[model samples]
Target: MQQHKVLLLAIASVLLAMVTIQSGASIAKQLFPVIGPEGTTALRVGFSALMLWLVFRPWRHLPKGRNWRAVIVYGLCLGGMNLLFYLAIARIPLGIGVALEFTGPLAVALFSSRRRLDLLWVALALGGILLLLPDMRSVDALDPIGVLFALAAGACWAGYILFGQRAGNLASGGTTVALGMTVAACFLVPIGVFNAGSALLSFEVIPLAIAVAALSSALPYSLEMVALKNLSAQSFSVLMSLEPAIAALAGFILLSELLTFTQWLAILLVMAASLGSTLSTQKKPAAAS
Candidate 1:
């Protein structure tokens, strides 16, 4: 009974993290007209870094030697992922952008697996991507540039996962993430300031930017850590497969972004692929045993 309660709490934590992340994206989108996506990314990352440093004090365990290289690359990937994701969503609907970006991790999973069953997941993901391609004849077609940016963000996400593991091995999760966020802030804050100028410092924008940082990064990261502590990695990965759908629901409710039938189907296909891939990975170990 105690184990069941703990598992339930962990599941809830993961779900809450997804909702918080998508909610942050919805709020951040609101800032685009005021400060642009660049500015918004800057504020989100900058404030996130500040909050993390205060909480984790990662400076105490700085990465050294080759670990520094890993963390640097990890941080660059983290920064690039956020920057491109914001840019993508500025042009596309939040749900679609998230779904497209999810391909990065999905690709990482599929490529690492040699199992024949993985092909099914790959095919499903490919079908979704194909369906998302802009149809000039359709009034609701997605922007090509936005699609490219989202795909690029996904690539960065894959890199983040790969490099993050290396960095995580070198330090505690909190320390690695804190230092990584600091690196991201250092790289992105300048571009934001250049793009938004003094608007970033406006009284009106500050509060919302902080909220974006909290909702998107700080809170979710904390919750994920809790979930990670209590849950098996396979369970966590399977739960995370729900992210695109949660993002879609959040976009619809918070931003009033409506998806066309085909787009909705595409999102489902991607979600299905992600879920299948995660489950397959879990089964692999059991089968080998």
Candidate 2:
């Protein structure tokens, strides 16, 4: 029953993060024209850090040792991940960009996998990406740049998974996240200032920026940390494959971006593949490594 409870908690937490992120993607579009992709990334991270500091008071927690190093890595990964993701979304349809970004976690799954079924999942996912791309209907002129950024985000996300595991094992999950967010914020300021040229500092944009920070960075990261505590990495990975579908839906509703029927079917196939692979290894990870 304890295991069941934990599983439930993890699912709820992850779904909440997904919903928040979907909203965040739209908010980002609003800011992208104002600050450009990199600048918007900086703003989101900057204000998210500020909000976390006020809420969590990391200075008071002051964890020491290996956790600190893990925190540092977590911070870098966190900042870099969102920056790249937003940069991707700015240029491409959210669906395709998200599909490409799926590569990172897919790599992680394959690396840890030995099952024959996992191979099938990878193929399905690839086929899905191809369907989404095919002359890159879902992408814009800058979409390739977005793809590259999404890959960067995926890399960062993978790193976040790796280092975050260490951090979660070592300290209070919430405290670790709070501190990591603060560090990410510190790193983003100079980049944001460079790109946005003080325009981001305006009082008028404060409320909007704050809302973005809250919905996108602060709330999602905190909940994810909780979810990690109750969920295995593999379980979380399986759940995450649904993100493209979520993003597609959100893009359609929020941004009015639409895809062809074939593309939607492709997404379903990938999702099925992911679900199959995950379920096959439900009680156990693929275990190749």
Candidate 3:
């Protein structure tokens, strides 16, 4: 009973994290006209780094030598992932971008697990992503550039997962994440300033950016850390299958973005594949490395 309750709590934390993260993304979309995606990403990541540093103070003991390599790669991946994702959403709808980005973790799970059943899950996930690409002849087709950006984001996400695992092995989990985020801000802050110019410093933009950092970065990361500590990695990943769906719903409700029935079905298929892949595989203790 105690274990079951812990699992339930972990599930709830993951679910709440998904909601807040996606809601923050939807809200960030509203800022595009003023600061552009690059600027928004900078604000989100920059502020997140600041807030996390204040909370965790990872600077107290910096990683040295080989450990620094892991942290740098982890930080770079986070920076690239955010930059590409925001760019993708600038051209495409939020839900589609999220679905595409989700392919990273799904691919990781498929590649990591060696089971005959995993093939089916892989196929289902591929088919769902393919469904998002309607005929090029269609007037309402997704932007090719946007799709490319999302795909790139997915690649960075895969790197983030791998490098993050390494960094987790090297340092305190919370400290690792906080320092990685700081490095991410270092990479993005310059680009943001150049692209948005002085507009990046607009007083009106500050409040929304702060809110986004709290919702999308700080709170979600903290909750996921707690959840991961208690749940098996398989359980954690399976629970996260709900993210694309939650993002879709958030886009619809908060941004007034709607998807076709077919698009909705595609999202469902991917969600199913994500759930199946994690659940069918034997549970593994959450990797701290």
Candidate 4:
């Protein structure tokens, strides 16, 4: 029953994450004509912070203690990770951005890997990135700046993974998420306002922003928590392999973004790396829903 529950959670997290990325990207595009990347990410995370705060009531607790320190770390990474990723998406195709973003967790997994066999997975992951890097005369102008944003996002993502773990450990069953979410929003909300202006305050963007907040932030975390209840850390990481592939497919289905055969192969290689690492590593502690 426990194993089965974990499996269910893992699958649910993958599907939800896919949907979250797809919807968030689509909404960002919609907001593009109006507010731009800074505005879009700001709205999404801003509203997300409100929702999390409402639920967790971070203000009720004093921040002078460990909670404040934990949130500082989590917020710093979360804010940077989101801002960079949004910038990356604004530059490149969503799928490509995600594929590159996977490098963070991949690097972490490989670095901590005990198995000599994991090197093969690293090679495959690197190969995937290589396949995506060649200049295609046929494709639209690629943004070198966007690629830089993605690398920046990748670095932040690694920080997110590491800090999240640290926060979780420090909180010891407390939900520190609200504090982190709130602080990240605080960091970005001002920039979004300056960039988007009163348009950020418009009624038209509200529903879409709410939907995006739920899809991208709320649902993914909830489902991931549920799944962690059942899966080992290694198994969970392996399952995350679907994130890039799903993002790509979501782009195709929702945003009318298409990919070349070479791109598809690149994604496949990354998946193989994730799978190999997951299967070869030892299990993590059971997750809590």
Using TM-score as the measure, the top candidate is 1
Off by over 4 Å in 3: 1-7, 283-289
Q: Between the candidate structures 1 and 4, which one is better when assessed by TM-score?
A: 1
Model 4 lDDT-worst window of ten? 280-289
What TM-score would each prediction reach against the true structure?
0.98, 0.83, 0.94, 0.88
lDDT at position 177, candidate 1: 91
Per-candidate local distance difference test: 0.95, 0.77, 0.89, 0.78
lDDT of 4 at 50: 82
Candidate 2 lDDT tens digits, 1-289: 9888888988999988987888787877788877777777777777887777777776776867655888898888888887788888887778767777777666676678787778888888778766655364434323556667777887888888788888767666667777777777777867888888877877865667788888887888878888888888678877777888888888898899887787678768767766766676665634444
Model 4 TM-score relative to the real fold: 0.88
Highest lDDT, which number?
1
Q: In candidate 2, what residue range of length 10 has the lowest lDDT sum? A: 134-143
Tens digits of per-residue lDDT for model 4, 40-64: 8899999888887666665666356
* Residue-by-residue lDDT tens digits, candidate 3, 251-286: 999988889888888888889898998877654433
Winner by lDDT between candidate 4 and candidate 1: 1
Can you give the lDDT of residue 263 in candidate 4? 82
**Residue 148 CA displacement from its true place in model 2, Å:** 2.0
Off by over 4 Å in 4: 1-10, 60-63, 134-141, 172-174, 283-289
Order the numbered candidates by TM-score, best leading: 1, 3, 4, 2
The digit string of per-residue lDDT tens for model 1 on 195-240 reads 9999999999999999999999999999998999999988999889
lDDT of 3 at 247: 90
User: Which ten residues in a row are the worst by lDDT in model 3?
Assistant: 280-289
